[model samples]
Target: MQTETLTLNGQPFYIRRWGDPALPPVLLLHGFPEYGGAWEPLARHLADRFHCIAPDQRGYGRSWAPEGVQNYAMSALVADMAALISHTGAPLTVIGHDWGAGVAYGLAMFRPELVARLIIANGVHPVPFQRALAAGGAQAEASQYINFLRRPDSHKILAANDFEKLLALFSAKMDLSWLSGELRAAYKAEWARDERLNTMIHWYRASPLQVPEPGQALTGLPDFPRDKLLVRCPHLLIWGQDDTALLPEATEGLEHYAPDLTRVTLPGVDHWLLHQTPAEVARRIKDWMP
Candidate 1:
């Protein structure tokens, strides 16, 4: 409901906040091409119960975006989040979607003490996701865009023609009813910020996670260390059955990593479920929150 700035890791980061400061905190992390405002709808829905804090994670919106792929590595990304969590006063619930989900998993895995609960929507867990990608199946096919995003000139392509490609990437095949002209403009503005486009794409380029080449075998790819990546907290995964980017197959076998996992699949919704049905998403998170 309100915007503020906090310096994390010695860099200024922007955040959107809602609800009473005295209430329990719930951190909302947005995915690529979106800023903290992406959580506005859901934040408003739960404002009465929880203090929703959505930060423009390092490389997007008004946040500081340091150059280079290495700067966007999981370690740096997680460190930025760890600093934010410490700044925000942790032991709070974390809600993330897409890339944000990856960060949430890392937080729960590497810094379990900071997270009371982890909730992800259409996000991947390392084990199952890598398996799906390495298996050279539908999930792998759907993830080809990750490779494209890793390209050096991806920003130009995404920014050309007024972010036409970016718009499609965000809303293609899913409902756009919620993405009004004003909302779309706001998103475009965020994407157009200084060094944000490449910085956002750097998140994909800096990762060790690789989407296997189409039809490629899993024989040579480095195996994920399952033991080290396990999330030792109550985890909830919400899936939109129609999400093509991160198929249902990605969620398979997640329980192996998250022993206390709750999975909820929503029919007819796609990757844009949060934007399409914010209230429903909020309700699901609220109902599941302990």
Candidate 2:
């Protein structure tokens, strides 16, 4: 594995690269409470065949994590990625998980030219995700944590006690065995950086997504241009049936947005399926990559 710092929108975004640069590039985007290193396990499996490029993304790891909720707006987050992709000067297969999926879908919908293919690991599309989040059902309940994370006091509370609450948030009914002792230390060390945790929480704060409470649906959601939200490229979705943070319902109408979509479900795994079954996930991605 190799590491480098690429400036995106004047911010130094740290990236970890694996495999020969001459190979086809597969851009990997990580979610919350994790960094580019989170893909180290999965990249190891695909290193021989693909150039696995994983970025720490804004507000995580060694990347330039700015302050304020406005800094983490989805547009800004996606723009950072768009610049990174533009820097590559070629369309590439992109893989995303959790919040990373948000930006991935943004690229597919808004800047389709930069994405050759889209692969989502336990991620959701905005339209389906928004409908589910507003439905006040299972997905709404699952996403209530987003509200908690957006709270102003959440950072201080999560920071207290050596980030005990943050750790619990990560293992929420998911398999974390893939996060070994060394990996755990790495994550904790990243979180320990000044204001990193707060900047991380800002992502939830800046998001326009709303999580309605169970039995109480939301009305008058922000107008989203559905016509422009289509995923115009081949899309692959890898699902972990056991995920608790985002139930299957959240991604129900994914096919509507992604016409050329293929889904592969892996049983006995949860949100952290990439870590638990990196080889299998890599095989699925490799088999599906076009």
Candidate 3:
């Protein structure tokens, strides 16, 4: 893979590119606590057939991370992606994991013309996630960390003890064997960057989803207009069943918004499926992409 710095939306966006630029493009987006390089393993598997582009979205890695909570809003996140696709001058397949999947869903909803196909790995659509969070059950308990991350001083806590708390967030009943000592060192180095940790946390802070207490009742969760948020493109959702942070309920009723949706559940895999099964993830995407 080759790394390049490009100017998008007047900000320097770092991206990892693989394969010939003349081939079909596939945009890859990584989630929090990880950068574009996180997709390296998967990109290598698909490079022969597709041109893979993974960006260090706004607040992570070497990308331009601006200040203020508003900068990390959903609109800004989606626009950043729009600008990136426009830079390529073509509509292409988009794949995201975790928060990255959130941006992909937003793109499919608001800018469908820019995405040919959508592939999401353990990402949630707004409705089911908010409903699950507000309903107050296992998902709500699993998401309590969002409240903690939203705290103003949470960055300090995450940075303490060499980011012990942050590391714990990545491993939750999922496989950790893939995260070797070298990879762990690399992640720590990436997290140790100046302001990156705090900036990345802003994604959680800027979100509108409400995570209710385990048994608390919710009242004011934002209501999404079904018509405006429907995704028109062909969509594929790949889920890791053992994901503790995002329960299976997150994918329930997703087809209401994505009429042409294909769902695949990977048993025994958890949130770190991308790392645990990169080749399998690539195969699923290749077969689904056409």
Which candidate model has the greater lDDT, 1 or 2? 2
Off by over 4 Å in 2: none
Model 3 per-residue lDDT tens digits across residues 1-290? 89899999889999999999988999999998789998988998999999999999998888998888888999999999999999986588999999999999999999989999999999999998888888898889989989999999898998899888877767756677787798888888878887889999999999988888999969776667789989899999999888888998877788889999999989888998998888998999888878
**lDDT at residue 44 of model 3 (Cα atoms):** 88
Backbone clashes (count) for model 1: 0
Error of 2 at 159 (Å): 2.0
What TM-score would every model get versus the actual structure? 0.97, 0.97, 0.97
Please give the CA lDDT of all the candidate structures. 0.87, 0.89, 0.89
Pairs that collide in candidate 2 are none
Cα displacement (Å) at residue 237, model 1:
0.8
- RMSD to the true structure for each prediction, in A, is 1.2, 1.2, 1.1
Better of 1 and 3 by lDDT: 3
